[model samples]
Target: MESPDPSSSAPVLLNIGGKKYATTAETLTQREPGSMLAAMFSGRHTLPRHPTTGAVFVDRDGKHFRHILNWLRDGDIPVLSESEYQQLLREAEYYQLLGLADYITEKLSWKKGDGTLETELTRKDVIKCIQAQKTRFRGVNLSGLDLSKLDLSEVDFSYACIEKTNFSSANLHKAKFKLVEAACSSFEHANLHECELTGANLKEAVLDRANVQSANLQDACLTGCSFIETDLRSAHLQSANLMGADLNGANLEGANLKGAKLTGTNLQGANLQRAYLREVDLRETDLTGAKLGGANLLGTIR
Candidate 1:
């Protein structure tokens, strides 16, 4: 087998996902020695050539391949729409271009091109900025927005209207929701470590599998909320309303629940080790399979 010369400036034709593309071998492998393109051009796989055009065929979306090729050519990411960015991210992940994927994720965050996080935006401004810049928002009224699977850490939404927002699988570490109205929202699998939700309205919210360690929920309304399999270690829930909340399999180790209303709450398989439950109302509550070793259950009313 004769090896192709690298110095030759011959154009290579590629047929990906039924779309034809004209490029160079150098462009395909630029800065990505371990990429899928590299593997395709490595001559290891038996790639079939076009019947008459002699173009190599690859089973991938050609529309996204153009953007990827552009990145390989100039190392500059073009401004894209939110849907386009998401599609490109999936393609980048498929090609094992982790750096590109991370870059896209960062671009989609609240950080601006100048590296400044958007910490001061109004409700209208948030929508405009998100649509124009394809970025997340902070310190704004983002009520009723679906923001699942996004990186929104370090954002401040104090006194903002955030009701019914979907934050599932989002990174909201150290975020502020003080005095915010976020009832019926979803925080499932979200990272809320050290987040402040003081006096917030979170009634009937879904927080299953979320990491709320060291978070402040003091005096907040959490009635009928879901805390299943959540990490609430060392969280401050003092005087919070937790009536009828489902906390099954939740980790509340060392958490402060003093004066909290837990009436009819479900604590099955939950960890209450070293937790403070003083003056809590536990009437009709379920503690089956719960770990209460070293927990202070004094003054708890049934």
Candidate 2:
């Protein structure tokens, strides 16, 4: 007695862990041919069915099995709660459903709105609401959040922990980042002009090609950060720790760097024209091809 063909339009019973589900063979094998369900039903080997119920047994979480079946059946996804969604996503990853996992991550983390259309009125309302609630920005984890191309100017993110967050190509002009910890974060090609970052820690952060002109970074730690070809013109760097930071081809024209720590920093091809560098430590720093015309280097230790 041979088993029925898996591709035959016959209904199949699944015993996923402890729960039972019923579906057609085509639903399991459709769309994603490389999926675990499809591979299981490929008839390459005989699957063990439940002894009593005669349903195919699968060693997976039965709770999130319905979502997988729903997706396979009609590509329908329910609006699940956050915890449920995460659980399903984890199961999807385990089952090698890359597309589904990516879709879930994007849906949950993508900021859907054009930042240019965010009016001052809307901003005021949001700020007022948060302030009324006496909201503290401390200890909030915003890692891997997509805030791209948003006009987040004047937004106070002071004392927040925003590790590994993405702010690429966003407008962050005059934003407050005082005492914030933002390690390994990406702000590539962002407009951070006149932003206040006093006492902030941005170790190993990526800010390549960002417009940080006239930004205040007093006493900030930027160790091993990448700022390649960035526009740092006239930016304040008083007492800032920039050890081993990459500032290749950066425009630092008339920038204030009084008392800045530049030990082992790479300033190759940087524009330092008329910049103030009083009492700054430039020890072991690479200044090859840097422009220093009319720059005040008084008491600077190279």
lDDT tens digits by residue: candidate 2, 6-73: 67787788888889999876777776778877777766657777678678877888998898888786
Clashes per candidate, residues 3 or more apart or on different chains: 0, 0
Error of 1 at 301 (Å): 2.7
The per-residue C-alpha lDDT of model 2 at residue 191 equals: 92
Positional deviation of residue 89's Cα in model 2 after best superposition, in angstroms: 41
> Model 2 compared with the native: what TM-score?
0.55
Q: What digit string (tens of lDDT, one per residue) describes model 1 on residues 1-302?
A: 22133333467788889988888767766567688876666545566777798898778888888888777765446667767888999999998877577656754653245533333444455445544432533334566777777666777666555777888998888878876668899999999999989878899999999999999999899999999999999999998999999999999999999999888899999999999999987778899999989999889886
Per-model lDDT: 0.80, 0.78
Worst 10 residues of 1 by lDDT: 1-10
